[model samples]
Target: MSGRTPSTRLADTIGARPVSASAVVYPGKVWDVVSEDVDLGRAGTVTREIIRHPGAVGVLALDDEGRVALVHQYRHPVGMTLWELPAGLLDVEGEPPLLAAQRELAEEADLRAGRWDVLLDWVLSPGGSTEAFRCYLARDLSPVPEADRHQRDGEELDMPTEWFDLDEVHTAVLANRLNSPSLVVGVLAAHASRALGWSTVKPADSPWPEHPKLR
Candidate 1:
């Protein structure tokens, strides 16, 4: 009744594939793997191990100066300290994604945004893992005072955050220099949304069923 009407109901299209059995194969600090016997229409039933992730949120913080904030931190899995947007895991039970994004932006980058909206949602390596992400576009930024900023530790202690012009981020995306999925998608989506007069952006509290938590 307010902005854009909700789209078609996409649920129940695919009937649930009967899960005969499931068991936890491994459990880690962040995620858990469970093996399941899943029914396949023509292929019969098959056993598969799926990684269950708690989901994540990425914040594309942009200042009124037209600069995008970025952070450089070590990614142990890839053995490289890559540049990325302010992001974090959604491990807290019952915490809304928008609130999580707000907390992450403040904690990781010492920044705050007055306006927030859904940029995009994606599933990374859906074949093996349930690592889904919701990226938010944050604007009208303000810097938190150094004295009041959150204390850092681990990789965060050494992580450096900086702002780059929108053109610079776009160029980096085109040059394939920025490898983080969240950053790349955020940049492209932000560019496209702006071109469309920001009509594509949804409210910060928009429902996201693809974000694993709701699924």
Candidate 2:
């Protein structure tokens, strides 16, 4: 085949032994047990490992008014109130990332988008565990007629959903009002879309805001 010879690929399953494991410090519905272990390698050597993970999702919902939806929530970890996009943990078994984004939008903000596109995939924290974040951008939006206040995993989230102009959101970020990555990335992506004239395809009655909040 085109004078190319395929070299044989060798595969091996090296045996490993777990010498010891540390007790989990935190346990949750989806992920549990922060742990450290000594894994004895096939070469008769042991390596210490530690892992901690809590997967999550984030969504940027764009409304026809040239505004982006944001949620104001109290984050206990940072001990402060922060504005963020609709997001939550991927707790459902075999739930697709896009589905999770849709669910999170409805659950967190009582909203949905006519068109949803996944824009970026990233790791929330790579230094510790195998937690990943899937960022999404939603355009042509519609709010859910009814909001279900039920907490998915018994986690209490007292947050209010509000819409801000794209410029306002970007300004809020520079002013430290919107500091979350999802919001930042979403706003940027939407702005890029606007720059490329993607917003013009919609109805002319509602035009993209000319003055983006420069912060």
Top model number, lDDT: 1
Error of 2 at 22 (Å): 9.4
Alpha-carbon deviation at 27 in model 1, angstroms: 0.8
- Colliding pairs, model 2: 167-213
> What's the number of clashes in each of the models?
0, 1
- lDDT tens per residue, model 1, 82-155: 88999999998889889999999999999988999999888888788878899999998888888889998877
Which residue runs of candidate 1 sit more than 4 Å off their true CA positions?
A: 1-16
lDDT of 2 by residue, 1-215 (tens): 58967656553232335656567777766666565565646565444333444466788787878787888887778887778888987667667556778888888888778886665555554446556666677788876775444454433356778888988877767776666776776677667767777542333122212111100
For residue 88, what is the lDDT in candidate 2? 82
Q: Candidate 1: RMSD over Cα atoms?
A: 4.2
